[model samples]
Target: MPRLVAKGRSHFPFLALELLTFPPAHRSDFWSPICLQVSAAAFQPAARSSLLEPWCRSSAEPETRGPGPRAMEQQHLASSSALRDTEEPASCSGVKEEVTSCSFNSPLFQQEDKNGITYRIPALLYVPPTHTFLAFAEKRSTSRDVDSLHLVLRRGLRTGHSVQWGPMESVMEATLPGHRSMNPCPVWDQKRGYVYLFFICVQNHVTECHQIVLGRNAARLCLICSQDAGCSWSEVRDLTEEVAGSEMKHWATFAVGPGHGIQLQSGRLIIPAYAYYFSHRLFCFPCKARPHSLMIYSDDFGVTWHHGSPIQNLVTVECQVAEVTRTAGHPVLYCSARTPNRRRAEALSSDCGEYFEAQSLSQQLCEPPHGCQGSVVSFRPLMIPNRSQNVRDKSAPSVQQSPLLDGLLKPEEVAGAPSETWLLYSHPTNKKRRVDLGIYLNQNPLEAACWSHPWILHYGPSGYSDLAAVGDEGLFGCLFECGTNQECEQIVFRLFTDQEILSYVQKD
Candidate 1:
């Protein structure tokens, strides 16, 4: 581990990561803390990077795929094959008090926008090729989900020192006569080198309860694409039939994840979503019908989109999927979703999001009385050598990978692979309320017992979050809702190195 002794703390300032704690009154450290506690995994990043050569290909230059620049009106798209983020890294807006300082490192999207309103349900995306992070959210006038809301986005330019956020941009360039855009879910297809921003449009006057009672699918499936990262985007593609096919006639309405999507290594693009099931007969208002977690997948590099079957016997909503393992022989996909039973639900799929195995609840992930959305991302374990991939992060801590460790031995010899995959989940760690937004890591993702103590992201009232692994640089960024006194006074963004996360190890 890279030792940040009592004095060497200057080199590491991201531990605003450490200051992210639950109700200080609930801890003994609040009164007489002899020393600050940090997660062991926090320090594991440098070591992990040095040991595992991150297989993530984004750290390198982004290559141009299929087509050249897609010409669009009012869209200043750069070269299709080039990367762009024209800004310098700057420090976070200053806050004086200790409790509020945690947000000083990164704050991509805050409550105060051009129009004074709140921004909630953050969705973060890390495109390896362009090395850009697109932070998307619902610009709401009030905290209410159905209130006056529009979609706004900010692009984070990686300028070596810090993330420089561009001016907020409006996503709904085209206006429908009576529709409102909600649920901003994006999926990146490495093969086609495209980013699909999938969302749904519901009539402004029609809410979820209104649709259920009406027993009709008022939600329209729509999408916009960008060939050169997020710099420019196509006008918009309304795919109500192409995506849902005949399923639109079903009963209730559905929504895409308010977070990010995944492209399985097998070349399938999957977006976590849920829809209410109904028939021609309308269900009563306080609808007893449940929303089941499902996937909207694409096969031909997003040329065609299809919805996957929901997890049987489980009711889930607002979830994210990640490829836990993607080497030659054994491949597994992990899905984490919010459940109504006051807990998070998870399922594994061998196929590319078409069908999943059984689902189960996580004892560690506690949902509030009302369910909330959470985010998940997968990456190479910073430490332990995965016997399979035969590669590790090259810049982690102090590990010197000799030929033996890298599996470059005699011609015919084989190496051992990790039995499972590793995952990082972000949610509010508070048991009863949506407070103390923290992140948990599982070195052995398949085994719930292996989840590490949460590395707190922000204290106080916090809601909906999205996690992104920053290419192969042994770093990651979290875009979440946090405030000093309320859950979402602001939507904050913070970038963390593996070393800083180790300090968040639970105090056993």
Candidate 2:
């Protein structure tokens, strides 16, 4: 069954409302999204040409102002098709050359009913087995955090190079009476075949500031699982008492990743979270509080949960976890988090999410002012057979190779081959404002210095984002908050290839 709401007006920058609908859901098609009365808006005539026009492209001219090496390289990138197509040697600083991006100009969650309902905080989960992508966001009464009401979802099926997206559906089971559900963090468990959606249920409209000021924990850890690849969900389970234990009393408030979580190689589910530590109290009133990123993990699938130690002596929040491991090497759990500092912070865990070590700030990954939520996803580097190995195999059969593997050399053939754990990060490239959503790559996850310059994804105002590895090793899908005038006006989804990431990412 599908629920439909009346069409509502949109706020600034949008013109006409387009009521998009899908046929009612059939019980047999589990992947079909239960259409809700969701309205997609089109830009005003004076605002832009068409909603389908791409915001940016690699082959398009770079928007330049003044002269500099970076600007010159951008000019070169724009002038040369060989460079744009990666047929010739591209300069290391030609990072502005955009990748061939397919922007679904239509938002998954738009500010439908601008006077009331809005969407924010996007989280993405890709189920490899089904080649399905689940996009989640906080359906709010307004853009404000306290107005968060429901968690909505849309399922996209991978069809060749493009995705066929279903209509939006609200996760009614993820909510509790008198409480608002926020932060939709979804993770897939291949072992038990469950898609766990983790979020915080805050009572009424109590803001995080309210909990921080009074030094009281108002948020509760809750989760709902879908056994049928997000088609249906189980009842909400409150894991606050069992997971946080007495730790909740020692702090103000906490929230799980406003992004996606990770599953370790050993079948452990890691949910990134942060809490305000109640450092000390004076006159029986708590005053000092600091944020630290921590983890909630489950070893026996999603049956039981436990909290791990937070990043010691560092102020970090809104984090994501990635399990990094070299080929035939031990696994290393890496956590990157948002911080108040101008740069993001990193912590490593050798024994899974039980403990974190080597906490430090990533000078290369700059964060805007007070910081913004970013996404980190790790994947194996694209590898090809060595020439000698190819010669050895020539006698067997001649098989067609993918274009992506054409230019790539084998690890044994090339010097400085890509490391085992290559990480893809998404955040705003601007240091002052949340604009110009950029995607960064790190060939060597263990070395903070190994991060390359970002490939700007979206040019205008952008905020919170989530990245999920899709298709091959280098292909990724980004679900983020972006708008023409302000962030969070709508949640957009785009896909990027490894070749695009490598072509646009410049190493210093």
Candidate 3:
């Protein structure tokens, strides 16, 4: 559900609102954010707020005959709303004053008018124990990914619905030394109380094309550790020689996730990555082609790392992984990656990401031409529907649903250490355009036909996204690239419940 904007813009200078649009001429009238700290009283309720008006009213309005469609809820969004963020969200440079946003989630990364950054990449990491969110982006001075971009970070405090974010700072600045540090893939070691941030450092002014044509892997795998939940970070550690070993000779280019990484239940730390392979012909000439998704894993909680066998045959890039129990009672590492042929490629690894048996292309999930990165998350709160419930729900045209429960759980899996696996994926909903972002739900990961989603987080320009579960609760928060007319304008965050996702079913 959408939260109401707080009053006192002058008193709370830390908030940079992406509210109802004004006009182009008055772009300077947009008051920038002040401090990161916000009082609890500053938060308002969503019901009586006028933040989202005219535009939001049509999409989320309710009918007199019934409550509302599960996909869209009707609410009279007011114009007098304010967005609360401590730092500059993946902010767009210019926005029309008439533009307004009304959704369950708001922008997390907004462009700063004072700063010259126009485009960047987004990555989100959530600490379940502390309810803290770490937002990472590759900051840039212009739209292109030249050798100038540096890694920047912002932290968010989630206490209930209100999230007070801190100011942005350059977290990793290898670019200052002439090399560019790109692609942030962060993973939390909940048991060890450590977070590992991974990235690749490319030589100064050397493009991926240059590395491919030379048939050499010039990118260096680097990592940094955080102990106090990102309050401080250790020095960068280069692991290219140890982890890549002789494999770098056959690699044109490689990098870890441009998103969040996961620590499996077995205490294994796996960072999703991919690389373009360099093929040497019989005449001793090297050639390059499609990339393959692979895993960089550390079995002893990031003490040491290794490169897993890449998923073959299917060309895949930028992907995410989750542990699921679709095969008998055993847990398998499942990965979903972006492809050029229009469908996302999925694979399962039995050896903790060491090797993968790639599944066929999923017709339900399509990959855009340029390929967009998607996010995957695993939580026990979700359950695959029983055989009978799926049939019954499909037959019924209209049915009332609990405001708190979706078809994610069945009676048998409701109690105990519920293990029936379900995976949630977030990506652009359309194949031809990067407009809508839908959350894909798959109960039977082995069966592509069993995949579906009931929630569309945003109906605007949305590109890449990362998903995180807040606490032990079924609540989820999404950090993604979104804008009014273009995907690169901003990076937004959204939180929703199972009920909100399944409320499409009529309420009793």
In TM-score terms, candidate 2 sits at 0.73
- Off-target runs (Cα >4 Å) in candidate 3 are 1-103, 112-116, 173-176, 281-285, 326-328, 382-387, 391-419, 505-508
Candidates' C-alpha lDDT: 0.61, 0.67, 0.61
lDDT of 3 by residue, 13-102 (tens): 112223344456744543222111121223211110011110000111111122134313311121122354334332222221121232
Query: What's each prediction's TM-score?
Result: 0.71, 0.73, 0.73
**Each candidate: RMSD:** 19.2, 17.9, 17.6
Instruction: Give the lDDT ranking, best first.
Output: 2, 3, 1
Per-residue lDDT tens digits for candidate 2, residues 286-316, read: 5455678899999999999999998876878
Task: Give me the overall lDDT of model 1.
Answer: 0.61
The TM-score obtained by model 3 is 0.73
155 in model 2: Cα distance from truth in Å? 0.6
Error of 1 at 504 (Å): 2.8
- Better model by TM-score, 2 or 3? 2
lDDT of 2: 0.67
Q: Which candidate's lDDT is highest?
A: 2
